[model samples]
Target: MSSEIAKYVSECFIKPKYEVQEAKQPYYLAPMDLGMLFAHYIQQGLLFAKPSNLGDEQFSIHKLLQSLKDSLSLTLVHFYPLAGQLTSLMDEAGQKCLVYVDCNKGPGARFIHATLDMTISDILLPTDVPEVVQSFFDHEGAVNYDGHYMSLLTIKVTELLDGVFIGCSMNHALGDGTSYWHFWNVWSEIHRAKAGESVPVSRMPIHNRWFPDGYGPAIYLPLIQPDDFISLQEKPDQLRVRIFHFSSDSIAKLKAKANEEHNHNNTSSEISSFQALSALYWRSIIRALNLAHDQVTNCRLTTNNRHRLNPPLPQEYFGNCIGALKTTTTVGELLEHNLGWAASLLHQSVTNYGDKVVRDFIHRWLHSPAVFKLDVLTDCYSVMMGSSPRFDMYGNEFGLGKAVAVRRGYANKFVGKVTSYPGVEGGGSVDLEICLPPHSMEALESDEDFMNVVSLPLKG
Candidate 1:
C-alpha cells in the first residue's frame, strides 16, 4: 500500500453506521406520464471522477470494485415483460446495488451501470481532466447535461493514469444538490468500511412510496406528451457549466465597498459577504445580455428543509430535503447597489422559505394535478445559490491527495448557474462559479467592472 493508504489504516476506526429508511414507492402519487421525466435523468447516470492509471494498488477503481464485492451487491431493477410494470428487482432485499463494467461488457464504460437497468448518461466521467491535487477543478467534466438537473462526472482513478473526476447525476425527484451529496457521503463511507476502514454514520433512506401531504405531482414533469413517452426525443439543448476562482482580499474589499453603499440605502443590518459577490455577478450577467439593469428576475437558494418543516425530519431522513428560497430583483437594482445592500435583498427572499411556508408549499404543489415545472423560477434570467458547506473538496479521500478542482454546472433548463464559496482567507473570502450562455460568458469575462471584483488567484 502507498504511504497515503497507510495513513488511512493508522487512523482511528469506528464501526460503520448505515441508516436505512423504507424505500417508498413513488408510483402511486407521482403522475403516470411523469415517469418519462424520471427516465430522462435516470437514464443519464451521474459522471464522477475519471481517474487514469487503473493499475494503482491503493486507489484503483477496479480494485475498489473487488473490495466492494464482499460488502455490496450489483444487479438491475427490471420491469416485467408482460405487465411492463417495474414490479421486480434483481437483487437481494436490503443489499446495496452498484454496477461495474469495462468496454467489452456491453456498451462503452461511458454509460452508467445501475440496478434499475436504466442506461442514462446520469453518471459518467471523462478521464482526461487533471487530478484534484493538480488542478483542484476539472473544468471540462464538472457540468450537467441538457434536460438533466445536476452534473454527474465519473473519473477513473488508476495507478497507470492518475487523474480522478468525481461527480453524480441525480434527478430532482430524488432530491436537490443537498441530497445528492448526502448520498455520496454514504457511498464513500460504505466503500471505506468494506476496505477495513472507518466511516461516519449513514443517513436514513427515503422509500420511494413515501409521500408527504401537500402537492400531488403537477402536470407530468419531464414535459413528455402521450406519444412522446414511449419514443425518446432528440437530446435536449445542453447547459454549459464552468468554474471560476476568486481571492479572499478581493472579496473583502468588495464587501466593504458594498457595506458603505448599503449605508446610503438606510439599511442598518449588514449583508453577508456572499450577497455582496452575488450582486456583482448579477449585474455582470445583465450587462452581458444587454438587458435593462432593472429587468425583474428571481435568485433562488436551495434552502435545507431538514429543520424548518412540520415535525422536523430526522437527521437520518436523507433525501431531497430542500426547497428554493426565491428573491426577485432587477439587473439595474442589483448592480446599482453595493454588496451589503444587495445581500439584504437576497436574505429577505431566503427568509421567506421558513419551515411553515415550505411545508405548505410542498403540500400544495404535490396535491395539485398540474405539476409546477421549472418555468416558475426560470422566467428570471439567472438563479443563484450560495454557502454550501457540503461541497468540501478537501474532505474527500480518493487517496492520491486532495481534489485539485471542484466546480458546479448548469442543468440546461435554466439560463444561469451561480454558486459561491467561502474564501480561502481566514476572514471572509468567497469564490463564485457561474454557468451562462457561451455568448453571455464571453460578455461577462470582458466587463471591466465585473472583472475588478472577481479578480483573484486560484485557491492553492
Candidate 2:
C-alpha cells in the first residue's frame, strides 16, 4: 500500500451481474479423488491488457461488458459446473458429505463491473507484483462447502486509463489450473467470433470420476471429515512477492550445465528446463536461509496426472487431475551436492509417476483418513511449486489484444509457494512468481548464485 497506489483508488464501484444457467438436469459432482484433496481452496488470477486494438469502433466499456456477459453464458453451456456451487448433503445412508459441485441449484457466475483511475502501464511495467493490482479482483470471502453454496466462479472487469483488466476467481474444488485456462480460452474464442461466424467446436469436459475396477462407490463418498479441512485463510505475516524472469538462453545454459554434471556420474537421464530452474531456486533458497546441516528440506512439485493415468484421460478432461511429487534431502546434502544432483532428484520424482503409482495414491486415500489431516505448511523447510511454463497465458484475447501481463491474485499468501508462467515477452523465457517471508526474500536478493541467472528487472 504505497502513496502512489492510493492515489488511483479514488473511484471504484462493484456491480454484480448473473447469467442464466444453461444446463437443465441436476448434476451431482461427487468430489473426485483429486478434487476432494483441494475441496477448500480457490485459484485466482488477473489478466492485464491495453485497450483493444480495434479502437472505439469495436471496443468500448459497454461493448466489452456485454461481450463478457454474453460469452460467459455461452461458455457456461460447455462449463456448466462453474455456474453452480459446492454443498454438503446427506447420503442415502444418512451420512453427511460434501459434493464438489451441485448444478441443480444454479445462479451462474458473478460478473462485476469496476473502474480504476490508473493506467495499465502503471501496473504491468513494474518488476514486482504491485499491491494495487489486486484491487481489480472480487474480494468475496473464502468458499465454504459445508455452509452456504456460492458461485464457483467470479469475473471482475476493471476499466483502467488505457486498458481493461479481467480478474477471475475459481473454486479449486471444482477444477485445477488446466480447467481454469480451458474455460478462459473457450470463453475468449466465443467472444471473438463474429455474429455469423460459427462457434468453434469446444472440447467437451469429462466429469466422470475415474476409479480402478472393483472399487465401490462408497469409497469416494466422503473423502474428508469435518475436522480434516483447514481454512484457506493465509497465516499472519509479512511476505515479499517478487517476480523473477529467466530468459531462454539462461534456461538453456542451466540445463546444459545440469546435463554435463549428471553425465559425469554416467546417468543417462537428463534434466529438463523446469527441473534445472527449480533446482536452482531450491539451492538459492537454502543458501539464503543458511539452515542447520541436519535440517530436513523438501520440494513439492505439483504433477498433472491427466496424461500419466493408466489409460490417459481425455484431452478435455476437467476437474482436479493433479498430485504432488515430493523429494527430500538434508540441508547439508543439498549444499554439498552439485546442481545436477538436485535436478536429478526432481527428474527422478517426475519419472516415477506412472499409472500404478497414481492408482496406489487413490487406494491410499480411500483407506487412509489421516491423509486429509495433513497440513501442507506443517513442514517449515518445504517449498511447494506449481504451474507450468507451457500454459498459454498470453493467448487469452477477448476480442481485444493479448494480455500484456498475467498474474495470480492469491499466490502471495502462501509463504513458500512458487508459481511459474511463460514470460510476457514470449519466446521460451520463464517468469517465476515467488512468495517468501521478508527475511528469506532479502537473503535471496543477495544470493550470488541466484542473482547470476535471474533478472530482477524492478530492482535498482
Candidate 3:
C-alpha cells in the first residue's frame, strides 16, 4: 500500500437489522438494469470538513463508524436489493443466460474502515486530481459483472487528518446515478434520525423493478457466463481529470444567451440550464481537441427515464431508470453556429424523449441486448455526461457535518467523460468534472471563450 492510504482495518458485512417484508418477492433485473452489466461499480465520495467541536466523543472515528454501520443496517432493511449478490443461470433452452440479484441467501453490504495521511485540500485544490484519491474507494478496478460473488455494494470510510471521506462503490447493474444518490440520501436520513425515532427515511425506495409492458422483468443475453460477455475497461493513462466550477451567475448568463437566440429565431421548447451548460462543454471540448471540422462527433446526454416513460415510474422506483439520449452532429456544423444552435440540439433531444421515443428505445434494446462498451464513450472528439447537476449532493448530512464537496472514485472513467454535480453555492450553480488528455486539458484551461465563465483555480 502507498503511504497516502495508510491503514486498512476492520472489515465486515452490515446486514439489515430486521427482516424485510419485501424480501419474499423475486427481485427482477429489467432490460435497462442489465444494460449496464459491463460498466464499473459507481464509486463516489462525500468529503466532510472536521467539525469545530472535535473534542467531543461523538466526533471520534470509532463513534462515526459505529453510527454509520448501525444506520446502514437500518437503511438496508428497506433497500435490501443492494445487500444481494448478482447470480447467473441458464435459460430453459440451456443455450442463453440471464442474471439477477440473489436476495434470499445473499451477503450484505461490505464496509471497510481505513485511515489516510492527506487532508481535504489534497483532493479539492489540485488542478490535476491526485492519484491517492483513487484509493479512497473500494472495487477500484471491479466491473458490475463481478457482483456475482462480490458484494453488490461496498462502503469505505477513510479518516483523514482534518476531514473524512465516505466512499461508496455500488454495482452499476443494480442502479443508476439516481438510485445511488437515493440510497445515500436515505442512509443519511436514517443516520441523522433522533435517538427515539423510528426509521426516518422520507424517500423510501420502491423495490419493484420495471420494464416495458410485454417485454421484460427478466432480459436474456447471448453469453453463458459473465466472463464471456464482459469487457474490462482499462484506465486510460493519457487522460487527466480536472474540475471546473461555474457559479450560478455564469450558468444563468449561458442560459440567457442561448435562450435569447432560440426565443428570437424559433418558438420551440426553451433551452434549459442543463442543456445550455452541456452545449458550452461540448463545443469547448471539441474545439480544444481541434478535431477536423468535418469530422462527425456526438454528445451523449444522460437522461433519467423515470419521468419520461408513458405512465412514468415514480421517483422511488428503486433500480436503473436511465438512458443516454444522444445527439450527433458534424464538428463543422457545431462550431460554425452560435451557442443557441448547439443548445437547441440538446434542448430538442431532452424535451423530445417522451413516451414514444422512450418506448422505441426500449423495444429496440429488447431485440438486441448489448451492454454499453467503452469505444463510443471515450473518443477524444466525443463527449458524454454522467451524474446530474440537480442531484441533492449537499442535503445529506450524517450527524457529523454537511458534505463540502462531492468527488468520484477511479472507475468507468475515460477521456471526454464528464460528471456534473450541484455546486456547493447552490442556486443553479454546477461543477463539471472533466477528464481529458494532457494536451486537451491544457488547451481547455487556456480557452478564453470557455474559461471566461469558469471559476478558476478551484479552492479547496
Question: Which prediction has the highest TM-score against the true structure?
Answer: 3
User: Where is model 1 poorest over a 10-residue stretch in terms of lDDT?
Assistant: 74-83
Residue-wise lDDT of candidate 2 within 262-363, one digit each (tens)?
A: 788898887998999999998888777778989999988877888998789875777777787888999999989989999998899888878888888776
1-460: candidate 3 lDDT, tens digit per residue: 2246536877899888888767766677988888888788999889998775745544678878888999888888888988888878788888778788887556689999988877787767767777787888888788888888889999999888889889999999889989999999898888888443358577888877787778766777876455643457566677788889999888899999999977877576789888889999999999988899889989998889898886889988888888888899999999998888999988878777788887888788888887766664557678999999888878988766678888888897887898999888788889999998899989998898899879743354
> What are the clashing pairs of model 3?
none
Judging by TM-score, tell me the better candidate of 2 and 3.
3
Query: What value does the lDDT take at residue 366 in candidate 1?
Result: 44
How close to the true structure is residue 167 of candidate 2, measured as C-alpha lDDT?
A: 81
Give the root-mean-square deviation of each candidate in angstroms. Answer: 11.0, 4.0, 2.1
Off by over 4 Å in 3: 1-3, 54-58, 194-200, 229-231, 264-268, 376-378, 456-460
**TM-score of candidate 2 versus the correct structure, residues matched by position:** 0.87
Q: Considering TM-score, where higher is better, how would the candidates rank from best to worst? A: 3, 2, 1
Best-matching candidate per lDDT = 3
lDDT of 1: 0.43
Model 3 backbone overlap count: 0
lDDT of 3: 0.83
In model 3, the worst 10-residue window by lDDT is: 224-233
Residue 214 Cα positional deviation in candidate 3, in Å, after optimal superposition: 2.1
